[model samples]
Target: MSLRLNCDLGESFGSWKMGLDEAVMPHIDQANIACGFHAGDPLVMQKTLTLAKQNNVTVGAHPGYPDLVGFGRRSIKASAAEIKAMLQYQIAAMDGMAASQGLTLEYVKPHGAMYNDMMANAEVRSAIMQGIAEYHRPLVLMLQSTPQAEEHLAEAEQAGISLWFEIFADRCYDDDGKLLARTKPGAVHSKEKMLAQVKQLQEQGTVTTVSGHTLNLRADTLCVHGDNMDGVNAIQEIRELIS
Candidate 1:
């Protein structure tokens, strides 16, 4: 069995810095680049795409809400039309950067709060799906696997878009197959625990949630958060364990 590892990169904006993206790149298979909405600018996006090309990493767009201050971690009130337009703009921007680098943008993954919101909000999910459908290009949707995720996946599948199920390496899970709240104690696992989880997901096809319930999961891809200090170390350990 094989699994793809992904990370959110290209998050720095202007003079601000976030993540040790260069250090993490060598260890990850796919790079989900931020598209100037939540945490990136054109310069950062271009630079990141170039690095991905040099490293031979798969590139995908990471679009989020227009909340730069919250880094798209805060939910905003917006209509479906507005949200769809915002997504379209972000996707187009990344597509332009990818084109310049002679690389095709492979997929789309909503970032932070937008990601969690779409899992349960049908309106948000529909808007995102519709935006992708209108693109007229083959693009995969990277998302978590859960009961709430089914509706979005179904919509994407029906629209002929590919779906990649993602599991977090450094995050805890609830019994219901949802990620544990970040604010909760022990919500994020240590590098050793993360490596074990990767092995369990890849070999046994299951993960034991925080509530002590084991659930079957497809480990198509694993994610490492860019901003976490332990992310690089965790990825290295995961690569060694999986190798």
Candidate 2:
């Protein structure tokens, strides 16, 4: 079983640096880059793409609601049409950015709160897939690999898009197969625990939830956040295990 690693990159805004993208790039298989919505700007995106290219990492667009102030971690009420437009606009911008530099975006991953919303709301998921289909691009959508993923398959197929089931390498899961809130106790795992998680996912194909429930999961890629020094260290550890 090969587990591909993906990390969110190029999240720096104007003067603020969000992650050690350069350090983290070499250890991962995929890069889900911010498309100037939640975070990142034109220059930052270019720099990140250049780094990913140098490292031979597969690139994907990380689109989110336009919430620079909230980092796209806040929920925004919008219709399916609006959500579709938002995704198309962001994905196109990033895809064009990648193309200009002789790189191609092969996938899409919604960032932050939008991701959480999509997991729970069928309408939202459909809207996002609809948007990707409307873009008329052949791109894999990276989404949580919960059982409900089946619910979104029709839309994905209807939209003529593919999907890559994603699992988080460090975050704790709930009994419902959703990620635990960051504020919750035991939501984030320690280094040892994270490694144990990888082992379990490899051997048992299930993750133990924070509520002491075991969740059967399907993972095509594991999300490794590249937001800080700890995250870089985690990525290195995860990369060694997966490779």
Candidate 3:
């Protein structure tokens, strides 16, 4: 499989700048942009779209819970209908922003707590899928690839949407193929180990889990975070390796 690298970006809110997006955008294939609900403002979203266009990077909506203070990292209690409405609103807003820049959002990847909740909660996952299905534009849904990938594919198929499974290059996974919580010990891999994981994925189409079990995961994309200069450098190295 051809592996495309994706990053969560456009996280700057007002005067608070976040991420080296200009430096990292050129090296990545896909940009999952935040859409105001989490970290982006109107200007930031427009700027990010412009940068993506200049670099010829594919853009996707990265919607999250409507929590600015927590950066959408904290989960909120909401019903399935509320979640669906929230997702559709964010997506429409993003599509509008992209259209203004002569660009189109190709996919949707929920951000932060929403992403984690989607993976762990079937009801939330279904709600998200249903929301995407009801959208005006046909867009792919990018989600984590786990042992339950087949099930996820079935759900997406039922929702009448396409799915792009993604794997994390620098995060450790549990036996069930879910990413280990960041609070856990050794949850994040070192740069050397991250490179090794990328190499293994290129060669074997698998990842070694935290419990030392080899898990087979089919991935169309690889997710990486480039928040700083060091991260930008790592992304450059990853680009070279994957390219």
Candidate 4:
């Protein structure tokens, strides 16, 4: 499949605000919207859905652990059953809200620590896959594209769910095909480097890792973040490049 651009949105709380969703929504093809577990409320989600619909962007559920203070970046320990329940709860919430707006969630992409844990822990990954499979309607599961693409695909097949392998356009990857920790230096790329990476992915279908290794990633979609003005501007540039 051709690579598509997606962004996380609807992260604003009642009084506080987060992300330049209004500015970034136009540039993206898919919107991974927060489902209130981490950073969004019903009203904010409704507004985001309306914005996405206005832009003709596809919607995906962005579910995370209930960690508002840490923005869902902090890991939470829970059983596989608990993880499955959490996934379903969030998906149901988003699905109902989207239905209200005459919209439908096209996929599920876990946020923050839940995302990382799903990538690293087999148990967590299985639970998430199972949850998606058991949902009332079919929904694709969007996750990082790693060297273990075949393995992940097999797991998805076993769970009876489709997969969309995603790549980060502005983040550094380790040799293991995992994103570098945010605390680490150079975990995020500057605008020039970010554009360069996207160019390489377009031209060569590979990325250079932090350890100076060439890693081939099967990218179905490219993920962009618009947490600031710079990020919003960068998304516009990236949209042009990818288009």
Candidate 5:
């Protein structure tokens, strides 16, 4: 069995560098590049695309709400129309950069809070689907594995878009297949625990949640946060495990 590994990169803006993009690129199969909404400028985006191309990694657009201060981790209030428009704008911007480099945008993954909100918000989910569909129906939507995620996937599939189910290796989930809230005590696991969790997910198609319950999951791709303090170490361990 094989699984794809993806990482959020190109989040650095201006003088502020974020993520071990250079170090982590070699270990990942796909690179979700920030599209200037949450974090990234034109130069950073271009550089990132080039790096991905050099590394032979698939390029994807990572769009988020206009909340750079919060690193796109804060939920913002917006109507469906606004959400759709913003998404289109972000994707177009990234697509332009990718085009200049002669690299195709392979997928779209909502970043941070925008990603979490869409997991359950029908309006937001539809708006996201509409935005992606406006670009190209074949673009893959990368999403977490959950009941709500399944709903979003079905909607995207109905709209003629492909879906890529993702599982987080650095985050915790509940038995119901929902990601644990960040505010929770055990929301994120340690490096060792994370490795073990990923092993189970990769080998058994299931994860044992903090609540002591198991949930079935389909992990087409695994995600590792680039912003974590131990992000580099986590990536190294995951690569060793998957290899």
Candidate 6:
């Protein structure tokens, strides 16, 4: 059972810093780096990719709404066309940044509200997938590992997009396998419990939700937020435990 660990990184904007990326980079297998619109600047993007290269961590574009003030966590209404354009633009910038350093983006993960919206709405998910298929062919799309993905897999496959199923190391899930909203109780798993969940996944290829429902979920990767410094410490612990 080779479960890869991923982290959302490079979220700093301008002079304001948002994460402990430097401290977290060396511990993970893949990095979902932020593009400028959400919570990064050109310099920050470049530096983040450079660090990824240095650490030999795989890189992916993390695009979100153009809400810098909200760290791309705030939802904004946009047409399907508009959603496609935003994803394409951000992914292109990340790819270019990677290329400049003789690297390449390996996947795409929509951030914040964009991610949540896509998870809940097949229309939005299909639109976003169609958009990525046009601009970033060949890069895997990292999305939640839910039954919804199976329902929409055909459309994405038709568009020539590959999907990467992801489970969170620091979050809780509903019976449906959709993540519980962050505002809800038991949404964020504690380090001990998070690692236990990881262990369960490694050993059983599934996890028990907060509702005590067993979900048969598989993953190409597991995620830990770079800003989750406390979670960062557990990365080493997870590796040691799993090893």
For each candidate, give its TM-score against the true structure. Answer: 0.95, 0.95, 0.98, 0.97, 0.94, 0.95
lDDT by residue (tens digit), candidate 6, 1-243: 788888888888888988899988888889999998889899999999999999999999999999988888898988999999999999999998899999978889999899999887878888888888888357888898886657667767887898888988878888888888788999989887898999998899888898898888868788876566676688888767666
Tens digit per residue, CA lDDT, model 4, 46-84: 999999989999999999999999999999999989999
RMSD (Å) per prediction: 1.5, 1.3, 0.8, 1.1, 1.6, 1.4
> Which sections of candidate 6 miss by over 4 Å?
none
- The number of clashing residue pairs in each candidate reads 0, 0, 0, 0, 0, 0
Best candidate per TM-score, number?
3
| Candidate 4 least-lDDT 10 residues | 1-10
> At residue 216, what lDDT does model 1 achieve?
85
Scored by CA lDDT, what does every candidate get? 0.86, 0.89, 0.94, 0.93, 0.87, 0.86
**Models sorted by TM-score, best on top:** 3, 4, 2, 6, 1, 5
1-243 per-residue lDDT for model 3 (tens digits): 589999999999999999999999999999999999989998999999999999999999999999999999999988989999999999999899899889989999999999999999999999999999999979999999999999999999999999999999999988988888889998999999899999899889999999899999999999998998878888899888888
Off by over 4 Å in 3: none
Model 2 TM-score, 2 decimals: 0.95
Clash pairs, candidate 2, are none
For residues 1-243, write the lDDT of model 1, one tens digit per residue: 688889999999999999998888888899999998899998999999999998999999999999999999999878888888998899989988899889999999999988988886878887778778787687888888775556656688776777888999888899888889889988989777787888888789888899788888766788977566577777888877667
> Which run of 10 residues does model 6 get worst, by summed lDDT?
147-156
RMSD from true fold, candidate 6: 1.4
Give the lDDT of residue 96 in candidate 4. Answer: 89
Candidate 3 clash pair list: none
Better of 1 and 5 by TM-score: 1
Q: Which parts of model 1 are misplaced by more than 4 Å? A: 147-152
